[model samples]
Target: MSSAIDSKHDATHVDHAADPEKIHEQRGHQPGIFTDKDLMTNAFEAENREHEMTLWAAVKDHPMACFWAFVFCFTIVMESFDMFLNGNFVALTAFKERYGVPVAGGSKAIPTKWQSALFQSGQCGAFVGVFLAGPITNRLGYRWTTLLGLVLMNATIFISFFAQSLKVLVIGQAFEGVPWGLFIANSPAYASEVVPLVLRGACTATLQMSWSIGGIIVAAATYGYNKRTDEWAWRGPLALQWVFPLPLMVLIFFAPESPWWLVRRGRTEQALRSIKRLGRRSGNQASAEDTLAMIERTVKIETQTGGEPTLLDLVKGTDLRRTIITCLMYASQNFAGNLIANQATFFFEQAGMSTDFSFKLNLINSCLQLVANVLAWPLSGWFGRRTIFLGGLVVNITLLFILGICASITQSTATNYAQACLGVIISFVFAGTLGPISYSIIAETSSIRLRALSTGVGRAAYYVAEIPMIYLASQMLNPFGWNMAGKCGYVWGGTAVVCFVSAYFGLPELKDRSYRELDILFHRKVSARKFKSTVIDVAENE
Candidate 1:
């Protein structure tokens, strides 16, 4: 069945590669040195290399790949602040109370409850945006889709500066969500496709590292403006996001398009041009040929596997069931209490800490996360995704346990400081492994057909879980106070168990496979946990 699908898709795609002019006309580029065959060869070579070598080399050699990886990492960091903002500072709450337009109930005013809804609405929009990627960007090309997303996100930030009402503010936020989905959906495949197969993991890790940078950006921005009374103080930090995207947009405009998307869309000539430029080889026809051949094989396999699976299929099919497990693995990270740790300021103050202390502590955690992210790149290579994700989950479970203890500490005896230090340590553990590595795994776990959809589903689940947590967070703190620590502790503990089980039974090893080869694995009826072992056994005996 898989073979049949591969052949049908391959035949359709190969026909386009045979006639390069058709692709050239579509992309509006003149005849180039490389041909579609050369692209095919390059892809094949990359895929055939051992997984560990390919993942790391991609990071070290390919500038274009690294650049996009950086953009994705930073984008996540920036967007994550929205999650922590209201949760972190009392000053922000003050701003809402002071400037907020009154509505029906004072507590449930336009800006009060509406602000919470805006966050949820943005998440909902993100779900829609993520779903949009498979069809729109899949047809349009990754480069174009990414650039469009970047523009919208930056525009959203710029417009947000002027938002007078909560409704207008959220509408701006919704636009930002779409671009985020595009980047998340496409960049993983994009980064993996461009590098030497040996260095793919490192390159992807570098992309994941951007989130730490984003964490720093949000933390620093929050800390810097924590006490400012000026109208533009908070707005200034928001406006700075505009600066990050403009230069990135220009770079992306000139950046090479995703070779896989190009090949899939039957634009083989452009695919050849892109691969050659990325490989830094001139007139190396073999590379282009390899790229085309691999893509041909992948497309054929996709066709045989059956049509793109729907959301319902996610719960029903073998490949898709694996995809769901992968999504759940990542979702576990979000719901695992890691985010609440980052947003600890809100809870800390509720426990009687001063506003100044909360900001300082949040900044400290961000710095710790930065150190951990840097450490993850080398650690991921040494440990691989499976080990790191599992280890992180275990450590997170322990930290949550400790946090519960610290939360019980009283302020009179300086025990609260100990609690703060423990929180920072937990942040370090999260940043080092699951934090950066999870996204890389998500990007690689599924085939192109369901990659975006799976990520959307996973992230949407993450946010959906967040909505309830956010709503009840303050209320929960009011009564249980220190006892509330166990709520997140339980969630993280459960998450750890799920991850362990998945690693033992459901998760696949995507450490070093090329996008095309990975596609073949998805078409089969193998168990996810067994895939790595299955692939390795076949490799070793051969």
Candidate 2:
């Protein structure tokens, strides 16, 4: 019955004049029975040409689609809250100053090391969460997996209001790892899939923008609330975070399911409907035919391979090599020594400032980072990835060395403030370039089948690296007394040098390429420009 249906469909496509030239090109495979099936299949495919044309035309004309695009952007923004809140412990500097335990019999010493240790615990929790995401998403699918994370995230934040002990604080922040991991693992892939290839960079960057925006909001809220009130300041910000996930939950309820997921499950009819909806929303800029062709090609690839490839499959060939390299690339971002440098408000206070001074300085640094994220759009848009990636590493490396010198010379004096300001400036510079662009490369480089797993692996590396970096930054700077913290410049400077070398030899140009083409670029010996050309050809042909 299935074969008969397929034959009839083939005949219908042939009568409607499917792309004969392309079909013939594919059919000239070899003198085999399989070649004959390809020709028959091409004939059946012709009937859908009209459906393709209409579906595309409708998508191009649809207005709601544009609105949904923004909906997509905002959903991603909610996830960006992880980055925003990740470092927000700075806002508690004042409270810590008045109430925190005294260190080594000091009258009013801030527990900077203790605080960093706590935060690193949260990062470690997030690592566990990231490791768990692959299996959860594999069993539950992206939508439900996100929903589960969202629920946990919101509950934890709300529960944080009741915290009286440091243990509870750690738990609140640690459980935060779950939703943060889920979103970080899945959101990039979702954003990458939703947009057309031409606007891929900008669209993905918009997700980064959402992150910056969330950071700005967190900074503004934490700074403003802490500045005005002495008590219940942290509570306000904690309570307000609940609002972030609510709207996203409502929208995802109404939004279309991922077409790729449907095709993977062999739900072709449903996938076609979802594609039509996407086309309708995109103002018909993409047709149903375009989406179907994409799904069809993807399905064909998977079917030919017999099943979804695993991590082992990645290790065997160019595809696996690309995955490993990309994972390391993201890992480098986490280990870039920037997070410690950026979130060092408590460290700054421990070094010599009063609690109030640390809070103000941390606010200022976050604000600067927000501004840098805004500014990055133009520079990253104009410059290619290689230049920005390498250049940023060099600039950061130079600053880290200079900072180490200043820290050693200043030793706990007024000059420390100057060194702190310089550190913030470097933070701004790093955020502007490598921040969003790193995400772009991560999203572009993985195959669809393995996207969730790859992203989870990459982010897991990031969080795992965070454990040591944050730990070292605190212990070496404080109790362990490595003097590296006091003159922390050399450590970060060395890290900067490593990043520069990595960028020079290891990174590939991923600018303006489709996700599919990225699959090829990572696997094949194609140049970046040629990779872009190949993707365009694939898109146009579809």
Candidate 3:
């Protein structure tokens, strides 16, 4: 094992002109006279090398890490599936017959007030759940916290499956949301921790892919059952929620706990074992040791600068800046016209599309979202997070404005179709960029000590923004309400413009940087725009 560095050493700036080879040659001549700085420098070099590794190489070296990340994040699929079902159930004929009231044309539709309540119920529960996830994960670690959520999800499904009243259904959705919050909050943090730096962006981004998968399943299931007049048309999809948690609970039990969490708890031996398990396919004990060393050093440095890990630290000093960045980064997703995608089926139905056509378009839209999410993996590697996210927002803003313009034209088949097509394009761009890159930003931005909590707070902010937006979208799309239909684009496009401006100024480029490097940058209070260019010498910093 390599010698450990003293945790209390004050960090200094590195001279960029110094050659690494010459420093190593000097160390080679020194032989047995190794210092703490030398050991720290070696750990940093190893981590940097790992960062410089290609995506394919990282996957080959850490296949188990990738597999486990997928397994844990798969919990998100269930969360998104149920959330979609909650929104789309209003579009189901049988669901409306069961729970809706008579409208002007003798057609039954869920009242706009009820629609807003149902959507906000889940967000309310998720807000509580995400805040709860922080302390629970801090105490029990990621594996057990996720296990508890999965178990609770099984019990919550019964509430939705047997719901006979609109109130009961709302309660069920809210109950189900608790576990969903736990899953969403934990997945990205777990993925970021278990994978190497090269895999971090791609792995964390998979959470969105999981979300898209769930949406696709819901779209297909709801499409298949859209014409059914029986209660099973709605109940069957609610019952499908049971299919995910049991299998995930089993798989997650055997998954390795995040070594970063283990290190934070001061369980170094367990952290080392976890790291070795994650990298077992590589068959390199030395590499495992080095990885553990890097995690410890990063954690220790954070501790030195930030002191004891507490939720309050999230709002103190430089951490406050980080907290705001994470909160707004997540909050921006909700503002970037995502509500249009979330309530697509209902929006299409109200926008003059037939029931059959609405379901079909939503299914196709779901499939496109899944494809866009998959494309995000390579795009993240190629163009980086900030560029893609900002670029995506630009496209979404333009599409939304065009959608509003289409709505202003004489209502016709062509104009309605144009608006629907525009919505689909916006969903594709969003799923590809803002949706996936936000996960990477949240994972990379927070300090390791506060990752789970920061993520919880960030995700909680998402629901905070989402709850109100869902209500507004319900009001905008409901025929009995505002009836803005496609014109709602102007409202959301304006918000997207706000998101783009904030991201332009606040979002930093984190591609190819290690967590340890990130800690140094954050601790130094580097400006957001300067993160990519700032250089640190790990030995001098230590």
Candidate 4:
């Protein structure tokens, strides 16, 4: 099949060795022999070498890069911990007694409006933080920006830990979200830049693993405290957040900066130094130089194609298409039933499960998600990104549809149990597929020149979409509001169908493709269906 497709586009492959002058003409320079032929050749050879390297070989060659990527991506656990704490707090008896108003059945409940507000306030701050991250990282670089965020996180946790009222807690969540935005937006891009192509998908996907780790920790903490009659039950989880930032700050201070960012800033010497630090095990100065040249060439092509990178350029030309794909890919997490998993503790309680059982189920759900995320690292390498993502979405849609059917029938212990179980299954499937793969896709989809900013935009879109979904999920679960219960599955399942369709038509297969190859394919406007099959010679001069 690949052979047939390659033959069909045989005319499209330009041979720079045969017609070097054509490269200059097509790239808007005068027809002439290459001025930096050695640099171009080294870059071409490096890209090909990277494309052919196995995952284990890449890991062995770049151990320091892997270590730093893990350290940076670990910052996401803080954000995930806080978000998970907020969602489960509503189910805490002491929390409701303190912050909630009177509801029916002679019991106290946090008003749906306040629940929605508390959940969305963080998202609002994250929205601002994501947009702010692009410019700040561009100026300060990833390491400094990360340190700044950690410092701010240390200061902001005071508000939540010491809050006297719900309003104060809301303000605290919003303030804390600013740094979280920095972490989420920066970490995946950092992972992408630090590692080789074979490690890129797994490293970026490790962000989701960190997130699930946070979820698991919070789940266990919340379960441990769910039955307590004092405010300490809720405050314990909030205070535990303080443990993450300082240690991460110390580690991040020692981590090397992104070489790609350095190259873009014209700090070639520093970029080479950073590359050496990243690939220390290889200890080959020549290989490091070739890698540096590869980054320089990709950056040059992006600049020639898109001119100066800006926020506005995200929506211009091929970049607009890239930006849309990244944004929607991130947003699809929510549309494809993640809200149900996120709010599982509250969701199960409202659906008539016992409070103790609900918390236990939430803990189980978190554990499953964590394991699924670990499994995804190998699955991603085996099945490829597009296949795993689309397959996961289909399974999610099917389970949610079945859950809705169970809800539509008579409400019973059996049906409620079925719905709760289905939510957990949906979450497991998501963690394995769409959840992790989206990180790789968004990181790979954007132009290297605009990668940090593009990732920010994509993450911002996730927070943006999350706010409404959080609100709607609150209403659907609240007895005083929509009271949809398991019926919410039908609505989310319908949305997941939309995501699957769009992805089928729009999500290209990016398995094992180098950044330069991706840039060439996007520049030429290749159809998504043709991406895996279309052949291009990376040796061809841009």
Best by TM-score: 4
For model 2, residues 1-542, the per-residue Cα lDDT tens digits are 13433343234333324443455467462323223333334323422432233223423554344345445556545544544554555436445554466556564433556556566766776787776777677666667777777777778775456767666766777777667778777766666665444334444555556665666676666667656435466667666678878877777667766666677767778877766665544334234655565556555543444376465654555656567656766777754547644455555655566656766776677667767766765565456566777777777777778777877783657667767676677677777777767776777777777766777788887777767787676655653345354367788778778777766766777654444445546555665334423332231222
Per-model TM-score, in order, reads: 0.80, 0.79, 0.93, 0.95
* CA lDDT of every candidate: 0.60, 0.60, 0.84, 0.87
Candidate 4 residue pairs that clash: none
Per residue, candidate 4 scores C-alpha lDDT tens digits across 496-541 of: 9999999999999987777888888888899998898777676544
lDDT of 1 by residue, 387-423 (tens): 7887787777777776666565554436556556666
Tens-digit lDDT track for model 3 on 38-120? Answer: 34554665565574567888888789999999888789998789878877888999989988899888999999888888888
| TM-score ranking of the models | 4, 3, 1, 2
lDDT of 3 at 487: 96
Superposition error at 2 for model 1 (Å)? 32
Q: Model 4: which ten-residue window has the lowest total lDDT?
A: 1-10
